[model samples]
Target: MPAGRLVLRRAAMLFAALALVAVGVADGTGSAVTTKPFLPDAKFDYQIGGGYPPASGVRVVSRDVKDVPAGLGYDICYVNGFQTQPDENGADGQPLEGTSTWFAADASRKQLLLPNPTPEYPTSTENQRYSTPYYVDPGWPDEIIVDLRTRANRTTLAAIVGKQIQACADKKFDAVEVDNLDSFTRAYATLADRTSAREGTEPEEGAPTLMSKNDALAFAALLIAKAHSLGLAIAQKNTAELEGEGKAAGFDLAVVEECGATTECADYAEVWGGNWVDIEYTASGFSKACTSVKSTISVVRRDQDVTKQGSTGYVYAEC
Candidate 1:
């Protein structure tokens, strides 16, 4: 063989050998990890508020942590991972059973750190209370944000929330949808700035600050590892900005709300590759999503409350 031809042949052989080794390494690492469940391109229902008999042709459904699976199709159990749900019992006003309690304490760890009293506004409602340790989100006054900055807090959260994901698997659900991944973004500083900008008022002071994006990511990674260990596929709920980080942290799919209305349907779709389920609350939003590239993204329109079918204000549509 010619010297030039011989040299080219050796180079080609070396490249092939390196390629084989790379493939072997990839297979070893990938196969050892649990594969995410396949999210079918079929009709899906987001019934987080309350469960109802799935409409005909619905192949997937997501319901609150307390609700049982629909038992007809793929089910995703929804768990509020980043914050505490409202106190179930109005009398005692205690945290919901089997969930994390959000209690802030001083550096001495003896006294509770109380939230500053929120000034009464014209729009304040009966259920909206401002004098508590919890920092009430502007729109969602019920959810008490949990602190995810400290390692101790994150560990406690993993123990409390990880059990919920485990329960989803125990209940035989197809996947788990961990909500409030972006709660950290709603921290005091960000919320105060946003609220002031929108309402044309001075920024609120004395708001308690908690988690950062990195903190949220770390907490999510813990939950994802726990979910995979239990053989359950976990989803990244909303928070389009963290989709890439969530994917890297082992989230299987995306559960997005109002992405279509916000013109962010393509963001989740790009990350999940049509493996996302988007729910828009308005008819116009649904229609717009249907016409966009998200047409094939399992887009649905549901009432803001997401009430069950046959109930008053029940609304559901699909693209």
Candidate 2:
């Protein structure tokens, strides 16, 4: 072979050798880990608020991380990853649960928590340990967005949240549904800023730091990686616009909210195929979703609050 052809051949051989190296979840335990995915297009139910016995044929159930596994199906533990999960009220000394009990309330963790951009804001302490008055997400005033603006902050928050995600794995949950991945979509400088957001666009970050869609995806990638490391499949929750980036980040599936109501279930279906789960809150939306999306992925209609069976206003339908 000519010198040039020989050099090209060697380069191609090197590239092929590199590609042959397996790309898989790195287990900190010194073994390669693999996540088990949920059955595609399985009968699904959302029990984020509370868990109950599945309504007959239900095969997949997602519930809040505070709850234990329902022990009946492919259980997914719901975790609020980008922001502090609203853990109703608990004093610091008394010990709270979830993120509120985690780093959010720590005054020193203000660096990890985003600054309250819009306020009757406090110049003083609000979360003696974890209240949103410090840097609460206005849309959900009780919740606070974590700082993902820097690598250091993301790393620190990942370590903190990863522990809780590991709990889901420990509880024998097969997967994790991480909510609030779109905090980057809304700029929460004030009450009005909350209403202003273009889908797929991260609101502009002003002074004290507001996250963008890119920031949200980056942080989500961390949690997804962590979940996989623990041998648990993780979900890309509700940010339809980020499905491509999310799949690239190794998310095993998606847990979508109101995709049916918004007439956007197809957006997720195109990407995740049968691995996505669609949730609807209205009858008309459910009907439409069943007609259009049910054949491709899981779809359900539940009460707006996602209450359990026998509760007043509880609604559960499957397609």
Candidate 3:
């Protein structure tokens, strides 16, 4: 072969090889190629229960999936993916006329219920249970955890939570924020008594199952895949410990709660960079976060309940 022709042929082969490698990379990681929307470093709001006017400069909002998105900016629909919300009447209150089925059930086919322990409004009935299948968090009796440990339960969860993600897309929201990714961590703490008692024994016939971190990660990945399929990006809500796993599971951004108060803001900042938003519940937390690197990471302080502006307890501030 002519020397020039031989060199040209080799160059062509190298270019083709590189093209194949690019294709493989794109296929192997959807996050690399998918155009998921991200949070902007603009005024932000986290109003899950009540709707409010966007403060001056507001450009991003996170509201309950059932609520309408802010008309002016990127909106994130919040879904409680790992636990059942309190009945429509409110936590530990009467279940709505036809909403009891929303809660999950345990192995014995019995609906698991947790007590509501709000100090100001403790439940009148100590044994009252919510309509959920997963074990309830002892510390937060209002939330009944969902079972993410087994495939069957995860499938069921997918059906339940996947609809919410779809709803977000249907509403034209930019992203879906799935909360309680760390419920598995709380499961260990809340289920310690039952797990310790049965450590060496055969499991009881209808005992509650506690999910491991891996179980939660797998379930999150399932939800992320579903959200992406619907053309909606997903956010990793809180759970700084799982930031890496959240990224691996295909979460596009983060809606972190109290990361600055807990000193875990840096971890999430590193993972999502400008794609993350943090909310602090206290004045001191807001101050601390504003002085740290998080000041540049889109931090805000809001009332714990995230009420609306006219509500008595409503609070909102930005770094």
Candidate 4:
């Protein structure tokens, strides 16, 4: 081809490339590769009981989202991704038998409550025994509830959580909250105990189970993707560790439990920006959390039970 013709062809190709780049920028290509924003609203409510049409004048209510509530302004979905609920008789009852492949106890001697001792906190239950099934190998199905790291687990979680997101959409909720993001840390003890037992070592008295942080991040990424696809906003339950792992985890806001009780409030505030709502279950905790983050973050207090509206021990307050 002639030099002039070649130059013209090159120019056309360059123009086409530029056009594509412009289109991507205009339509969110950079956004596709970047993290989502964390926006905490000023006025908020945290209600997970009595099926969601929470008391009057409440603007936000965190719920299971799987069952969307009627006339809810904002909905945060709850998912037990970390620990498994015990079956009849717990270990003696085969708590996780059908659902989990992971279960181990040295000598088959059953202990009521498994022990968990973290530096800042300890498992509240002195006899908290979970069905041994969820304690099985993390790789196996039914071992852990959420299994955020496994593709299979992620798929299952997404489906269920997705339903909640859809419910939020259906109910016209402003966002979706996912609980148990911090279960990885919470389950660490139980998981360690299982690992020891599998290796023929005697299981510790009350070890907690641990989830793979990498896997959890991957799972959150997928969940975020689904949420964004559905045009629904997502919440970071309580996993402060993921603050630096990249925000593609589909979080737009945060709902922290006992932030006052735990030192994690500051971490959540830093990561989620100024848009977060914290719940304090104790009077001391509520006062501290509100005093500390009230100016920058929204804070509230609810009775520990977080019971249904007319329940005996219902308590709710806001600061």
Candidate 5:
């Protein structure tokens, strides 16, 4: 070959080798991680309060994944992955029985932390106090025991939520809402003390329970991965602390309760961008959220009781 042709041939061969190397690196990175597509600036209504269809003009509705459609816009299924739903009877009926307990600060006992209290609200300090009207069901328990911080707890919850995920797929919903993401910081004062008490105990017996904070993140990541694999969007329900960790945990959307009322909407805006949906319980809260994020995320107001439609009292408003 002429000198010029020989030089051209060598250059083409070098380029081919570089392309192969690039492909190899791309393949390696692809196997390491996968991300979900985010659906920001969407509309939604949390109507698990009423089993009925969403009112006119509502674009999305959240319901127990097990239940059929309520004839709403897009379906955003509900799953109590972080906490258990109470049985029909009452607190005495049967606890959601999460796998982990508070592990009192002393590490001597396992206790359940109560859901984070809304503004000016506190979870029941005692079980007796929990039995009161304000502490009643439909809203949330003043407190309950959980094992969510353990490997076993993570596995169990993953399995339970896996079933719920399957339900979402079977029902053909667009997304899944995992409630109680902020329970860790909600009633931490009281429950944190319990976990301290229960530390350094004998190896816990019984089924698996709550994973450690690290474990919880791992579990959340797994759920996010699985949901994404199935083409269902996974939401981070009310956990602002987790917002920084949201992308790492694999959450695609957010379902915030009272963010505007508590001045927490900005955080959601930062994390989920326009993909958040804030559910306010008061008119003031609704106004605040609408004024701020309506141009981005969806906003709505519902009765504190989350009452059913056509009932004596049911409140639903959108921004």
Candidate 6:
């Protein structure tokens, strides 16, 4: 064998490896998985409720994981990645039992679920007695947190979400947006989120679940890897604080909600550049976001519910 031939063979192998990375394949290590990233600053819309023919020139749209995508340009399938879906209950208001049984605190008591505490059930006594499985977001009671405290749990969740991503791919969506990336801040904040949320009263027993930013980031890696392997880009929803880690974990874009309202647009912009989209729900926030980054980033003002164009409160303004 000649040295020149050996060098050519090695170079070919290297180029092949790089090509593999570009097409999105994952080996579990964050380094190997990469996707063809979506272009930055496209006209965008967030329509999680239901699909509609997108507005003229809209290049990106976000929809619920279960719903059909808008099919305009780059569709993002939205999944409640770090939390239980709000609609996970039977019509009777009890947790569903079959395939979607996200766990419950029954006599068996092995499932990782807390109570949906309220004024009457502040102590989680009645809520638990009724087997109401939840440790919900303070702002959105129906949205509950999932346990990402262990490797098994994280793997389980990743598989669950991976199926949702597969559905998006099956429908030909361009991307997936795993929402509630910041759920851990509430799930683990017993001192601040638990006690304080309960009117400064003593927190109930088993009040807080063991979810942390580290768990969320680790979990994001699983989702990112799964998305990339499917040749679909993944969005880092909210949690601008985790933007740096999320980017390193192979997140392809950012789907920010109220960054202008929270004054954290810069945090996301710093890492994602203009490859991020912002949805503002308030007039003031819309003004700020449009005034600041609209020239470079994709910014839109939408109704709080992201109502369809025909809905009464529907509002869509791009800046």
- The model with the greatest lDDT is 2
Candidate 2 per-residue lDDT over residues 132-161, each given as its tens digit: 245554445556667788888888888878
| lDDT (0 to 1) per candidate | 0.63, 0.68, 0.63, 0.51, 0.55, 0.67
Number of clashes found in candidate 3:
5
Models 1 onward score TM values of: 0.76, 0.79, 0.74, 0.63, 0.66, 0.77
Q: Which ten residues in a row have the lowest lDDT in candidate 4?
A: 1-10
Tens-place lDDT per residue, model 4, 118-213, is 322323212223323233222222233444545775665556556655656666554566555655543455435544544445444334444567
TM-score winner, 4 or 5:
5
Worst 10 residues of 1 by lDDT: 1-10
- Arrange candidates, best lDDT first: 2, 6, 1, 3, 5, 4
Q: After superposition, how far is residue 209 of candidate 5 from its true place, in Å?
A: 16
| Residue-by-residue lDDT tens digits, candidate 5, 6-37 | 00112334433532331111111244332223
Candidate 3, poorest ten consecutive residues by summed lDDT: 1-10
Off by over 4 Å in 2: 1-31, 88-93, 97-104, 118-135, 188-192, 195-209
lDDT of 3 by residue, 1-319 (tens): 0000000112333433532332211323465444345534657888886778888888888888889889666788988777666556646665532133345333332323232223233222222344122345444455566666578778767777787888888888878988777766554322334344324322333334355778888888788878777667778888776646777777777788777677776777666666678888888878877776444457888887788889898888888
Off by over 4 Å in 3: 1-36, 89-101, 104-127, 130-134, 189-209
TM-score of 5: 0.66
Clashes of each: 0, 3, 5, 22, 44, 0
For every candidate in turn, the CA RMSD to the true structure comes to: 11.5, 10.5, 12.8, 14.5, 15.1, 10.3
